[model samples]
Target: MYRERAIRLAGAVRWESVSAGDEPVRVLPDGCLDLLWSSGRGLLVAGPDRTAHLSVSAPGERWVGLRLPPGVGPAVFGVPADELRDRRVPLADLWGPTAVAVADRVADGRDVAAVLEEVARGRLVAAGGPDPLGAYLAGRLAAGGPVGAVAAEVGLGARALHRRCLRLFGYGPKTLARILRMRRALALARAGTPLAEVSAAAGYADQAHLTRDVRDLAGVPPGVLLRA
Candidate 1:
């Protein structure tokens, strides 16, 4: 089974363990990035995705990952989030010898999550933490606020907000909002809420709106995704 736990780190939401299974798992966009380590594949970085990611695992393969909260990834990774958008790159490519050292530590069977967290914490501290405005924008957008309103609240104009979002989230504010809304709807639906209520409560215009979004972002309808 898959397991996840919250960890104490700025911009890090949790650590996760993905179970090895016969079938692949569909990971939907959640406006976040991940630093992942696999028993056989070493270390990799999962970028912010605009659509569902079909993750496959070999038999007996185990995986550990740290999910970074929105707007926090760029600072920790030392690049604009768009640079890694919709891609998984070898950690060595980004971190050089540091990634190799991390792989060695993982091979030693130490707590992979803790190692990854320490690495991220070090980078964030060196970088002076995430941008306060970006963090504020992320929070407001994830809360289902309108993009225009969020920008205004943060004292940013529309164009300025778009630029900041592209740098921090790898996409525009509208796209980020869409992804966050889909995540909210899915969480509610998986918890056994009816589609109609989920659509309304998640800020969609109607069930059809929710359905279209689910299909577009997740590559499946809500029913199929939930069943999976």
Candidate 2:
């Protein structure tokens, strides 16, 4: 009971879902953050996660979300990404009454997803939009660039790049790279490709390497995620 569509926002997507049953949903980490509205919770934010998140839903609860790409979240949320890592905070907690006003609009029969998109667009503009550095760093790491080499490519030292990643992506370059690699490997595996080939194609040393990394970040083996 979930569906999503790409929106005009850069690298962002709008998604809606309804809880179908009582089972806890397995939400894998994807190096992104989400602006969320729950029927019960109103306005909320989902931070980047370092590990898998088990989402327990009340039956038929509706959810609307605007997912911002990794670096884009820090720009829109106006908080360092690390502070919200693995956490879901009420939007009011950060924006105070301004967020409550946004919640009120959505609750008043306005288009839920559209309201979220409008708010995000407004905030992104005020913040001067997303930083170019974040996109470059994330892109390089996701493309299998070596951490040190990529850091240098950005004219940043290791520690400096690490600091920037913490502020922008809620993790260091190394961890972000691992997460990106895990996602890539999983996507290939889900395409019915063999794990061995997936590992090689996704830049892992071998199948065992892929298994360990996936289990570490996602809290499950490759087969488990595929079946889910």
lDDT leader? 2
lDDT of 1 at 216: 98
Note the residue pairs that clash in candidate 2. Answer: none
Stretches of candidate 1 above 4 Å error? 18-21
Question: Candidate 2 at residue 33, lDDT?
Answer: 87
Cα lDDT tens digits for candidate 1, 7-121: 8885575556555677878988877879988877889999999999998888778788889889888888888888888999999999898888888887787888889998888
lDDT by residue (29-147, candidate 2, tens digit) is 87798999999778999999999998987889999999998799998999999999999999999899899899789979999999999999999999998989999998999999999
Top TM-score prediction, candidate number: 2
Error of 1 at 75 (Å): 1.1
- Scored by lDDT, model 1 comes in at 0.87
Alpha-carbon deviation at 36 in model 2, angstroms = 0.2
Give the distance in Å from residue 179's predicted Cα in candidate 2 to where it truly belongs.
0.5
